[model samples]
Target: MVSWYDPLVLAQTGVRSIISATIGSQADRRLLDALAAPKVEPSDFSVDAAGRPREELWLDYVADMGDGWDSTYTIAQTVSRPTLTLKDETGTTHETRGGEVLVFGGDEVYPTASVGEYEERTVKPWTAAMRGQRPAPHLFAIPGNHDWYDGLVSFMRLFCQGRHPAGWETHQRRSYFAVKLPHGWWLIGTDMQLESDLDEPQVHYFQEIAKRMREEDRIILCLAEPAWLVAQVRAPKERSYLNNNLDFLEEQVFGKKVSVFLTGDIHHYRRHANAEGRQKIIAGGGGAFLHPTHVPRKESELAEGFTQRKTFPAAEESRRLCWRTLGFVGHNPKFGVLTGLLYLLLSWMQVADLREGGTVTWNLGRVLGAALVNPGVILLSALLVLGLIGFADARFGRGRWVAGVLHGCAHLAGALLAFWAAFAISGAVLPLGSVPQQLLGAVLVFAVGFLLGPTLMGLYLLLSLNGFGAHPNEAFSALAIPDWKNFLRLRIDKDGRLWLYPIGIRRVPRAWKPGETAREPEWVADDKDATPPELIEPPIVIGLLHPH
Candidate 1:
């Protein structure tokens, strides 16, 4: 099991954070890459497909792909993406074009905050994916938070090195990069520096790219995190490096010529659009724990110029969106069970009494009093109930108290509900002649609460109604919690119409047996359920882009 407290991981992250702070991530890249780094690892690269340049470009994009590659997270955390990738490679992708340019949006590995993990998680698998292609497509990548965890050490090595891995070329040297497509299409991808903010150097780097762009250049922007995550405060600018830089790129670089905004972080697929028809696509389903796509957001609208375009299992409302992929996943329940046991042990240790006669007595109230002992519980609970006024009071648009209240109440409610249910059920299982039936009831309650560990925590975090980074972002996640795992296929046809396909996962393509060609997966999607080979064009605000 991968413990977050693993000595090596903590040591690497702690050390890397200090180093990154002192010198910045990119400068360190330049220094460490002196021997192999190119003099000019550009912010963008211009590409012509098939040696005959066409204005239109075709590309495939995916992100959040570092988890589950080898079941390294079986007992440590959730593992889904790697298996999903295998499914895609082996079968799910049989019907789609793999794109001439396969861009790895970001996040090469999970818990990948260390350089030591990149090779095992990202380099080996992705290189094989690229190299195994009949005529390998060009591979480009950006650094996600996980990649940044190592200060971009492993990211630069895999993508910046001149040599081909498994024969697939990765030509960029820096974390942020762009690919100049034909016609007026430009694919600009940025790196969200640590804590989701871009530093001064990163700002200047994009500024240079912006200065070189034409007033009329249309951009296909890539961001590490989705801009529309917080439905309440969607200004196209969140208080983060990625969002701030996106603003600069629009205001300064291409002069607001952004045509398509693509991102992957939320571990599900969503196509958000505004009334004007500008598209913001979230296709984080490359391989990770599935995030739900809640239908009706508490926010009247998700955000300014943002609305859910389309999602699978299109149910409405957040409450209906809970219980995400409850089963049918390979997640190990051992760690969760262990956690439950730990909670029970702690509760027992805190309240168990030993008498001189070697008798033991249980104080149930004391056992659960970690919560009741808090002086602020009543104030916080009242604040949570009254804070609903903020929903009515436009004057106090948002405040920390509102968030804290909502979170506290939700947690309390979940705990109470869980404890009550467990006590009721466990109490029923006891004999009436028991010396103290409440003791057994209390132990069972503790067991149930801990066993439902994440479930309770997820409930608490989910109730943060502020919509400002709610743990599961009630908007995109809440109900109809399907494993909306997927990737995006963006193709600009010969006539320059851009087609965006959100390919939802069926199953990881089954592994090929001996003597099998990579032509198809062992099990293909049934025709009725199969995603159409060619995607329909999404409505765009700026100009007409249609298939010929």
Candidate 2:
């Protein structure tokens, strides 16, 4: 895990001063001037066959789009999602298709941002998917947090190269770029500072770009992170780094004019706007596991210029926040024991009466009540006991039951003492309430239940299952089905009007399975019987997306 950081960042502008003086302030005035020049000759990033730029440029895009574990569960949409030939809502069968220019918002590949990962996760899958195409769509991308995880070296090699891995020309010179489109439209994308601060180079680059563009020319801004997610869920008003960059771009650079704002990273589709018409459209469902679309419109904490227009697979008002946090915890059961142990460690130093509840002589009623619950707890204890038994039996003979019991008791005593000391210090000021105490105890119980392995967990899931999260079938105890996985097809027509098509997919395309090639699904151009594209209703208009 060698990283460029002096291991970690120094601060906002503290240690970053070195990077700012060196790389950020590199002498590139000649290149900047040339790029910013008006009426520049077209290079490889060309328009249609006629070489005459058309007024309308079609941008088909996806984001948060890479498989965590190969392609089966997460990357199916990435590999298999071709515009199926199907009957529209009117029942007339036709080829529903995608745009010509393919745009990737960010997080093109996942797990890590290494070059090898890009090759396996994005390049190979996309190249395979290119089998049915003639001239591939113009490919462009910006770096996400995952991409920056490896210091943008992989990002530059895969994306900033002259040609992409799939043999498509990537005309973007920098990780952050400005694409000159027809009809006075500009596609501006910037590399986010890994959700902290925009680097000085990026700001300087955009400033030069602003100096070059016409005052009236509009921009379709591509941002790396969706500030709304962090702004709403993680922090109230903090973690607005992305939005702060947006404001800087609009007010300081672009003079408070942005035609539209596009972002990814939430793994769901959301369209937000306000009365003034500025929109924030999140299309992170390129290939990652789905994020729940259950956040209520009213509960959304949008800025002055943004409000929720629609979220597909319409959902209900959210439940209590605590339950939601628990659901997130249960999504990956492998981590449940560690999380539960932490909770258990915090439980040792409760009020005296809470632990020793009975009088001097315990009633038979209380004893019976304790017995009923003790069996389950006793079974959980056996796991620890067996571990000690295994260790002692390996060293001593099977007859050494006394040694095993003593070892188990000794380990338990040490654990209890450590937990007691930790909890004593914390609970002095924590004031942990009754509900939190009960919730932690329940989590510990569930963790023990899961420790019985998948068979028992599966059986418990049937009786106590709530729904799934992270993936279509990954069980989460509190949160229900994660409903949204989608991509957007944005078009700017001859009339200079913007159009948005957010299409939802129920399942991902299967990938890297046995007989990997032959088992692959073909792109059907005339399958009207397949799952028809779930086109969200009330076709979105350009006015709804434009700058106020």
Candidate 3:
């Protein structure tokens, strides 16, 4: 369990300073450029004091929407271990002093978010983390792609008041809701399923919210997935939010210098500069599986500097704020390579002493002679060896060739070991017909049956589970295990810039521009073809996502 990484990072004299020297100033240029864009044509788009789109009105007035409410609250209340703290970028501990809201990205349950999924996988762990915690944060969330797998009913019920014990619904509103925060902060939450259109009622609700923002002083938007991050990672291939013209909302609100966005789902934390000098925080790493660390694309940075697309330079400036900090930090702890090597060495030592440790001695010469004379035992052993090898190959191997070889060896070795053990035990014991002898025979047979059945069953499952004509790669690929507990958390800062703090790492990547990574959806043939959707009705109200 020796850790090598601890010293490696500690040896550096603050890599942040080194990285900054190599890069330039961290100011956002995009926000400055955007301020020069045309002024808000309020008449062209009917908006309320809040500046929310008018087509989306019903959602604007939800119990959560207001100057000081957060409909979607994202809480990283749980820790992977007993020692970790559930804190925010400001080191505000959430273990007891709960925030008012919570948000989710996707895969709330590891692989898929099936109905009642949380009951089996996450609810207990989450509850354990909050046991006796003083205050509890209200929860709100949106459906990510993983959440969409089982149609989100399970997720909706767990958070929305449909089930209990095995459920986590703390309120009555559907999974996604908007809450108005104090001091003109309007928190808008929504599903990231861009393919589906917002229902007419919901659309109107959001529009009315936009109208209100026009009159408001500030707004923060909370979304499960950081559409900005997705745009950077999967540029030219929009994930969800970006596909729905959320970028356009950024452009409209850029001059306001008051809107901030809070997002999660990438499983990494990031802080980026908004074109209007606001902060965009990505708090996606909260006990969940970590994602690849990313750098801003060169094209994005060159096209619009650090404004819309946050570049590394902007991150350097972000760190100077001093309010940012991590709730927790961890490493794999055990060096996997070293651990594997030690285990292998121990296994080798055990195998070397196997013959000497066991008090059994076999008359191999006589047995071989007998086997040569009859040949049946040898033939049976050969067949068993082949089966054992096949099983071994499946269990230990990776690709087709290695897997086949290992399985074949395993089957052979298992049969030989069983035969030898049974033979030695039989030779040392009494003949059958006695009470003790019969009992021993029964027990031995049962043990052998138990061991052999699994070998046989495993081979059968391997063969039968794969559909005809399916590639072995595809069949075996899915059999690989996946980590079920990848919890991520996100939070937004006061400046509207995002600060992403992964639970495992203290250093975060530099933020990218809003549109630098913005990609036109696949449905849109190309970037040029990806025009803002034409509005037929009175401008739909879309509330700005509030930073929690």
lDDT of 2 by residue, 1-548 (tens): 01111113213223334443343335422234335443332222225577887767666767876554322133233323455443334555443455667778888876556777788777765666555543467778887766766556677777765765676667766777777666666778877645345666567777876776776666778888777655544343445665686677878888745767888877667788777666678877666655555542234456675667776545542222213433343444544454246325323222222345342212334323443355443454466668546534221234446555664655443333333333333344444434454444445434543333233223222222223211112222223232346777776777767666666665333323332343343332232322334655434555423543
* TM-score to native of every candidate shown: 0.66, 0.62, 0.42
lDDT of 2: 0.54
Candidate 3, residues 1-548: lDDT per residue as tens digits?
11212334223323433432232123322123224322322111124458753332111111111000000111222221223344443545542212334444444554444554455445543453344443334455555555544555566556654354322335424544545543344556655442333433344445555665546445556565665555543435344437454644445432353355666565444555534445555544433433323233333542122343322213333223111111001122222222223222222222212233443233444333443444444455456445444433232224434444454555434433443444446546865234464345345533553445334334433442231211222122222211111223323333333323233233221221122222311111122322221111111112334432
RMSD of each: 8.3, 14.2, 20.3
In candidate 1, clashing pairs total 19
Ranking by lDDT: 2, 1, 3
Backbone clash pairs for candidate 2 read 65-287, 76-509, 250-256, 273-307
Taking all chains together, the TM-score of candidate 1 against the true structure is 0.66
Q: Rank by TM-score, descending?
A: 1, 2, 3
TM-score of model number 2? 0.62
**Candidate 1: misplaced stretches above 4 Å?**
1-52, 69-96, 114-116, 127-133, 199-205, 231-243, 274-277, 295-306, 312-321, 324-338, 347-455, 458-469, 473-482, 506-548
